[model samples]
Target: MDTQSAKDTVDIDLGGVSPCGEVIGDLGDDDMVTVLTGMKLNLAFFSEKVANLRNFVMHLETLGVELEGFVLDREDNDVDVGCVGKFLEFDLLCGVLGSEVVELDRFLDTLYAEIADAGERVTSCKPWQDNLLDPEQCLKQSEEQFSEIKKLSASFERTLSSYKRGGIGM
Candidate 1:
């Protein structure tokens, strides 16, 4: 059968319910499938980005610790001319890291909004009843990933705050 005819058949089989479900409004099976697949792909892409961000934050934390150590080591010595340049460099680097954390916090906010929107879309589609998608599993996976990102982001924020408080050097 042609695509249009096949869609008509499916619509008839659904007893007036569109294959896309009532909330989605008048989309055919192919369209619904495309949307669902796109949602899954987006979730996976965001999850990977979040993981990379987590790694970046952890690396920053390590750098902060090492810089703290360097500052402590220098504290015992008399202030040398060379130390002024090192302190300036350290201040500049800290400023860069602080700006990056602000950017990442904005990114996390966007991710949270996307996840919430996707969750609403997933729940609205009667996927479990229609056998269109596994809503429970998809939601569970996204929630788990989101929670992990939130926790990591919070920890990074705390670390960044301490760094800002002259934990490395005034």
Candidate 2:
């Protein structure tokens, strides 16, 4: 195809098509570099978010352990109605936190997979700057995954903060 026609063909954006679907195959070296750089940035951002979320989850787990210890220590006290009620509340909170940890673990697994896929796409396209690869799709998917994870992280943070204010472990 002629240069003008090639440009026209590439410019025809089809909604729902992968960002790099039609363009990558025809991209020049400079364009490939740009795309690769964007993908790298996306990877970096995703890795940082995942690390932060993991740290937060670890902190929550630690809090749960400490609260459990406190509850256990209180179990030996002389029988009292209020103490029993607090014990039940703490047990429920710990259970809910444990379930949240499990859910976060599952999410982390999926996020890790997305990161790995993005990394692989970047690696595969590095040496040859292969036109057939779809790094943009990887970038798009990573953005989406991180966005959802961020929302979940924020929600959990709010919930934990509310619990703290309510004197959960106090």
Candidate 1: regions farther than 4 A off: 1-17, 20-24, 76-170
- TM-scores of all models? 0.52, 0.37
State each candidate's clash count: 0, 0
Candidate 1: deviation at residue 103, Å?
6.4
Give me candidate 1's TM-score against the actual structure: 0.52
Residues 1-170, candidate 1, lDDT per residue (tens digit)?
A: 96569767765444323444554444445655565566556556655655665666566556656655665666544454444454455455545555655665576566556545545544555552343335436545655665665565565556556645653333
- Name model 2 segments beyond 4 Å from true: 1-24, 76-126, 129-170
In model 1, residue pairs whose N, Cα or C atoms come closer than 3 Å (at least 3 residues apart or on different chains), thus clashing, are none
Clashing pairs in 2: none
Please, what are the lDDT tens digits per residue for candidate 2 over residues 1-170? 85447657787533322234432344454455555565556556655655565565566555555554554555433444554454455445545555654665565465556545444444434453453245445545655655555565556556556546645434
